[model samples]
Target chain A: MSRWKPDGRGRLEKAALELYNHKGFEATTVAEIAGRAGLTERTFYRHFADKRAVLFPSDNPLPAILADATASAPVPLPPLEVVTHALIEAAPVYEEREDLVRQRQAVIAANPELQERELAKLAALAATLTQALRERGLDTTTAALAAEIGIAAFKVAYERWINDPDEHTLAQHIRETLDTAKHLTTPAEHAAATDNVSFTGQQGTA
Target chain B: MSRWKPDGRGRLEKAALELYNHKGFEATTVAEIAGRAGLTERTFYRHFADKRAVLFPSDNPLPAILADATASAPVPLPPLEVVTHALIEAAPVYEEREDLVRQRQAVIAANPELQERELAKLAALAATLTQALRERGLDTTTAALAAEIGIAAFKVAYERWINDPDEHTLAQHIRETLDTAKHLTTPAEHAAATDNVSFTGQQGTA
Candidate 1:
């Protein structure tokens, strides 16, 4: 009943997710969501541009945080490291809204249009990471490969984290996944080449 | 014209791409594409299932080839190496159809629906690679990450190959790009510890 509640956005997101889950994203109206949150439609609009926006409210801040993390990361960090730093910085934001995240994923899974929008968002994120890597003086191929690999790692880690939340923190899981990926990708001879032999090959197309 | 020509599929693809470029994919009918190819609609159907199928002719063979390559690859090959070998197997197929490939890229670029389809295809390819890797006794995280990174490397190399044909062969370009991605992603200090010191970090949210 407090007029000046600090968690108004959180409350609205919680209500919107519940409504979206129970009645579906298409059937859930802003008025109903506002009512469920004990707020006005105007307040709901203030929090989210629209119902679809409610499912992806934090996306706005994602680019900026990623950019900042990439920029502040230690210079000469490997391409994945640069990307991993950014993911780590962004984890807390998603962690704070795990339920909403799950609901959003479910809604997206059910709707092709929403899935396309999500894909576009991911593509945009990759583009941003590529640009950031380029700014750090990585060549075009390296930048693109780094951005892509980074995104792939993020995706696998995220799916695992969501499915098995009790096992490890998202950051830990992602790190472990990256390590394993690196290990698996390294050639057996390279694994044995502890002293001096450098494994050499063409970069991307092979 | 010889009725038993080996380039029947190529001719059809060329004709279809030209028609698609001129009239747009949605507006270009199968009959028109067949006419341009100097073949009957029945002949076109023999080669392709539909108009949309022309855009993705390699859909059937790519996964199988990738699976075979992954399965038959030398045991304990590095993740990138395994992916590189699979891509190498695919190189000749892509190299032989460079013109059609560029045309396909243009057509997909013009249509959001086509782009989505392409994205879905790429995602499926990644999944196939992951599954193949998993069957090799790699853990889920390692398999997923290796597949994703390999695909990322392939994508980067393919783009470069399509953009500049003179730089290197698709297989060579892919190999170089994979190496570049791996090297760039490797931590600076532990560059020597190729196997022991695994690079760990979070993906950038940006």
Candidate 2:
């Protein structure tokens, strides 16, 4: 008990998943999670805030990572592609966790509070991406639209990736989804657009 | 007290807003809402399931209306224009309620639980639009993306409309937002889309 364990967090996550699967999320306790992980309740507290947090993935540094990736992308890539690269670069953390992710999603789906938290998290991600695009010199509304489109693509891709029995990367699904979205949203009213407001070629970033 | 009022829902909504503004949402109750509306609690129950329902705009028929508009639009129009037409057709209901809409939004913002409910409501609206697009012969991913993008444009446009004290109608705002979205999401990689899945030249309702 006095010895240090480097895999404290990972063990707790795994233990929590097993217990959650068998005993259900609301019925499970923090002490039981720590016990399943062969650790003390003090160690659980050191890692997670509560039993629920163990099942939920951490998105702390992701916004910064996504923003940096988007800013560094090639000057001419469209907004969606820039976001695709950013999300793809950040997809490794979600790799190899298919079983856990599906299970966690089921647990969340069964609970309305968890579902709201999930939506809030998704909204936050979209807002972060929107700000990142704005920093790249796009206008506010354009940045917001592009960020939302990117998120829509990511969501479809994530669900598709998990549903397929064959092993596939989240990044590939995102790339393909973006292509489909691009083709789908392609403008047919270019004439109307030109008549409406001529672009200055240098769009402002607010 | 026994007067027969044909506009019970409208009166209840008006009364609820007055009370909510005076005493905050958490402090307000259904009995009070019914009392202010000059109706019985039983009457209020017949109209709305709860007090929160009064704040949320009834969207029961909106999905069908939007979908029907999209399906009936002229062929060769872009996805954004199709959505614009769909929303513009649906905008009449919102045209006369600017004050109520603004107040409802304010009331919703002040409470976290209401905010979550608002997000959920938005998601449902998006889903309904997605289904509508699907009926227009769009593939699943394309349909979902277009609907989400359309909703984003509507959200931005609605906010801009409320903020500007100017008297631009919601339909005009929606039209302008769609044009803006078109310029923003114009695709860069055109080669991959060529022959990937050629449009039917005359796309139609399914």
Candidate 3:
């Protein structure tokens, strides 16, 4: 109830999420969120621009943190390695806040608008990773490819980390997901090209 | 001027793109598009749900076409190849309508809402491809990974096909982009792993 609480933003987020899940995102209001957190509406506004902003905060740190990590990777490493390495390096960002992240995912999953925002956020993260790779001297196409694949790997890893019952660390999940994704591209040694059955060659007359 | 025209939908689509590009998507209206197409507003309604729907038509054929292609592919191919082969098979959808697709991309790029719809469409396409791969007997994680990378490859190739002056077929571009994406994961023989300098190994203490 103190006005000068050190974790005002965190309190507001937790309260808003609780209200959103209890009723619905559309039904939740800023005043109710603030009241739940035992803070003034003014304090809520100071942390977030609006109710929806509580879910999709403007000042996300993941993009910048991953980008910085990617940029600082040692030279000559392949772009995928550099990007995944950055992801592994930043795993604690989510690992340390797993509960909040899990709740946010559930809330966002229930709302179509928030789902769109989630996709946009992921796209922006890919763009940031692309820029980071470009800074590492990769071509635009290669940078984009690596960044997109990196984001895909991260998504797979994060989903498993959240649902995993074995209590594996996010980094281990990431390493496993990265290997799974890589294995998807590499043809099995037993599956020879001669034995491969490709798609019907219905050539388009372009 | 003829309501009975066989290509009424195509004409309306073309008119909408022209107006959207000439002015803007927000500024353009169904009446204006119908007028530009020399068709009645009712005819426009029969084709598209709304002004925005002109850009993001509801009856998107690409997903179903690609899914069918993937499902029809010969068995035992790697998931990536199965997906990319489906893409190559479905390339004619874009190749036959390059001009309209290019103009549509330009219009969508200028509008945030349309961009979101485009992203959603691509995500849906990935989901369809993933399901197709799952039917092909791949695991959920592997199927999703291959589908995502396949879409990324499609995006890269589509951009090149739209902008390339040499008039290469979309299938060719897709093939090249797939190779590039696969090559990204493979380490160079000359660049020895022992000699390779990886990320600073700044592991996150999760």
Best candidate, TM-score: 3
- Specify the CAPRI tier of model 2: incorrect
The top-ranked prediction according to lDDT is 3
Q: What tens digits encode model 1's per-residue C-alpha lDDT throughout A13-55?
A: 8888888778888899999998898888888887889998887
Per-residue lDDT of model 1, residues B127-204, tens digit only: 999999778765565567778888877888888888873657889888777776657556763244333323222222
* lDDT (Cα, tens digit) per residue for candidate 3, span A1-206: 67558999999999998988889999998999999998999999989999988888888788878888998888867778888899998899889988888888888879877777787788888889988887766666677778888887787788778888777999998887776666565566313321342321111210
The interface root-mean-square deviation of each model, in the order shown, is: 10.4, 16.0, 10.4
The superposed Cα distance between candidate 1 and the true structure at residue B82, in angstroms, equals 1.7
Q: Tell me what fraction of the real C-alpha contacts between chains A and B each candidate also makes.
A: 0.52, 0.39, 0.43
Candidate-wise lDDT, in order: 0.76, 0.72, 0.79
B61-109, model 2: which lDDT tens digit per residue?
A: 6677787898898867666567778888888767778888888877877
Candidate 2: residue pairs that collide: none
Q: Provide the DockQ value for model 3.
A: 0.27
Model 3 residue B156 lDDT?
A: 74
